[model samples]
Target chain A: MADVPTKTARAEWGTRFGFLMAMIGAMVGAGNIWRFPYVMGNNGGGAFVLAFLVLLFLLAVPGLMAEVALGRYTNKGVIGAFRDVVGRGGMVGLGVVVLLVNIALMSYYSPVIAWTLYYAVHSLLFTFTQPGFEAEPFMLGLFDNAALMIGLHTVVMGSIAAILALGIRRGVERIVVYAVPALVIALAVMTIRGLTLDGASEGIAFAFTIDWAFLTYSDTWIAALGQALFSTGLGWGIALTVGSYLREYDDVPLGGGVFTAIGESSIGILAALAIFPIVFAVGIEPDAGAGLAFVSLVEVFPEIPLGGLVAILFFVGFFLATFTSGLLITEVSVTTLAEETRFTRTQTVLGVCGGIWLLGLPSAYSVDILDYLDFVFGNWGLPLATLMIIGIIGWVMGPERLRLLAVNQNAGIHVGRWWNPVIKYVIPTVMLFIMAYFAWENFGTAEMIGGMLVLVLFPIIGYALMSVIEGRGEQPDTADLTGGDD
Target chain B: MALTAEVIGMLAFTLLAFWGIATWSLVRTLRQEDRKVEILKHQDRMDTYSPESLAELREWIENNPNDPLADEARQQHNECVDALKHTDMHYYDWSSEEIDRLDRV
Candidate 1:
């Protein structure tokens, strides 16, 4: 009798392009569009770029490679990955640490996506071009109207939930392949338009002028470090979760590490080109904060030629950037819970999105709550997740094992021994430094206190919860901790 | 206002470093994927590791035979060796002499 082939029902990316696009879409958020440009505008523009590039190569590149390799090597989501490494005990709680942080981040981030969605709709209406329109009051009106904010938040979460319910190929991959390219093209068009404007060179000079002094300043490095790490969404479990769905014969190092690290950040450079030239051309005082995108850019839209069309391109692209991130950020939880629980994918989507929406209410009701959570999570929670994931790969599983097993397996570019030390020593050290530096900078403040609480409380909560479930030994551990297992 | 040569130079450097490298990696990886798919269509399986990486895997398996992942690594290394000997086309550059020298762990 002839044996028939049996294909597993496992959902993988339909194509390599879909997987690549998903990484870019998940990493390039509203921060890449606005926060990066904002920081660059303030720091010596060219100097900041120099600092950022150095750190990106040293830390984010190798670090991301390690994170992606661990995911592909294990082919599991956060918690399962931890169990695979640590032999199915309380130590598996480390994965829960990552999951909790991912959810916490999405809770506030979903509301921010809602903000962009609101502006994207208005930009479609050419609201920025309306007579007697005020950018400040327009922004304030949205921020102040709690009902509208909550409604927009609900809408954003609903859209994300609907997309996620479709599963990986039909859901996330289908949207990102189109959305990511559309985002790049939109920014590219805006960049061309901005560059051709009068006084555009002044904006360019303001942004690209290398003050050699900034390279000497610690503050410049600090700003660049923050932009490089946070802006790339390193550790956050987004990359790991995305990496988990990698198909057989997929290369992790090149696509997941090099391409993703540099590719998503390239959008930030595009953003600076798109926004600053337009701002200078209109003689608007450049504000290098979140306000620049929401308020300052809105003001400039009325003054430029074909400004209404520009508004459409910028806001729509901005919405795509944040919305895709929202989808993936929430997917980290959806992927993990769906694995751990007996629930269906559709059920997981509803449960995760509902939880995010509920946690997001306070953030949705007020901008202050959003900013507060952003600082806390951005400073401590994310680095903690990074520490957990990279720490496990570095110390527990051993970087050499993962590198040989996954990183160099069909890798586009060969990664040498240099990556091991970076993963083992460099990344964890940098993560610790980032958390400590931020704490020292904001010492004794409420934000600092909140960050401290997260650092302490999250691990305790994760350990206790996992201990109760796993200590009972309801299932066999079956953890393969051969070579490199510490 | 006239632009300084320094600012222009910085802008050029940043653009080349970010977008230039990004475009290169994206194109290269996608091309690699295409090559892999084409190879798999012809052969049941393609070589999973390069010469250097396969050697590294073999060395690792030899050095740490007791490691939990050693069996998996050895299997991967041997699979690549088998594919190299049997397949006409290869993903990584491998000479017939190199294929002859290969052995299962």
Candidate 2:
């Protein structure tokens, strides 16, 4: 591997607050607000929450920490960091996997951010709050309108590109420093308002009440684990890219990884508080599935006092969370290009965002495309990639060495030897089982095959071709084990 | 299990406490960062020397190698040079071929 630079000029978090906020902002996306509530509600509420917490601590946090450590220790993006950690050559394939997952995620995710932005504007305009409002038709019309979808998508992607072009501290940190606090306060206010509604308590009961029956079902555990992983942005290389910018003194174990996980998981609960009470108060179903936020909330908003304003605030918060998360995901791709290829940050942003915008066209045009991409990447691609990452860290790099070199090195809360076994054995085993179950359930579908071929196989082949084209050359000396001062 | 008055009260309290802690933590960290920013600004001034000034300092250190301030000035000059080199290195990008070659070693 190329030697670690004796000095680095990479951008860093300006403050601990900025770093933590960015991390939380990256983790607590619209998924936490929408997906988590319905999933928790569907999977026995408190029981699922319990499983999710356990998995977050046991599997997700360690995976996140390992990624962060890889990024910080190597001071490289996913591809470069992988090469640094596990020598070079074919490790490029692993990098490709990480890069492709983020890119694929961004393709579908950005459009959703656009949708949130659209809904936020729509709420402000009182489009849906008008008398004789029909939410289904309104949503259908919005989704079917390719021009509007693409316009909003362009706007969202363009804004992200603009922000990223300003560099890390000036752009990402500054935005998240304001956006995350705003998101939290908005959710808090919404929760307070929602709680004041009649019958709101029923929703809270539904959310927190445990149905022990779900504990017997393996699917519940798997779903909870998946939620935790996706919710915390594990296996996505975002944390890894974010970690690449960490100053030497930034704590990884406690403040960086653990605290972010805690903060993110709390947002899920907070979202449930903000959402469920309003849903029950308006007599809408808590397990309204994916439509809980978009449809159900739209239906209920007009019934409540000052619902129009509340709707605007909620969607604005949703947009901010998703936009920030999208920014981080896009950064992974941007950083890779800027570091690995002959692209400056500005050129990389243009190339990456333009590419994602084009790729997201089909998703913008059709719900099927979006769902297909989400199913493939979110369900299969992410889990598989995450498993591969942990396996690399645990087996290839030696979990104990990673612990000493990455986790415990400059961390305030030193990870113990227990981390080694948990990462090396327990996490991988759980991940493997989840992947297997998902594959078994999803394998025969045409969408699965097409997605695997397009998303998974195509990337691997492209990387192989690139590697061959590049050819092997003289190797640089091994990086100095002593990480240089920033 | 029902959402009684106490349950509602507990939920509200918990969320309030979470918001409180998050706000407090953010405020504390931002305050600490303000102080760090002041120190960093000063350090930025000390660390940054113009290339012409650095060249002169280098010449001065070479001429007065044994002078009391020679060691300190030389160290500062070297640090500035290193920082410039680091910045230049970051500005340039590596090709896939170069990255592969680096990985091989």
User: Interface RMSD computed for candidate 1 is what?
Assistant: 1.2
- Model 2 chain A: which ten-residue window has the lowest total lDDT? A477-486
Score residue A87 of candidate 2 by CA lDDT. Answer: 55
Q: Which stretches of candidate 1 lie over 4 Å from their true place?
A: A1-8, A472-486
C-alpha DockQ of every model: 0.82, 0.06
Using DockQ as the measure, the top candidate is 1
How well is each residue in A191-307 modelled by candidate 2, as lDDT tens digits? 999989898878888776677799889889978888888888876788888888887545676555676776887888889889988999999876543477678899989999999
At residue A48, give the lDDT of candidate 1: 94
DockQ, 0 to 1 scale, candidate 2: 0.06
TM value for model 2: 0.81
lDDT of 1 by residue, B19-73 (tens): 9999999999999999999999898988889889888888888888988778888
lDDT of each: 0.89, 0.74
Q: Give the runs in model 2 whose Cα sits over 4 Å from its true position.
A: A1-8, A288-290, A454-459, A462-466, A469-486, B1-105
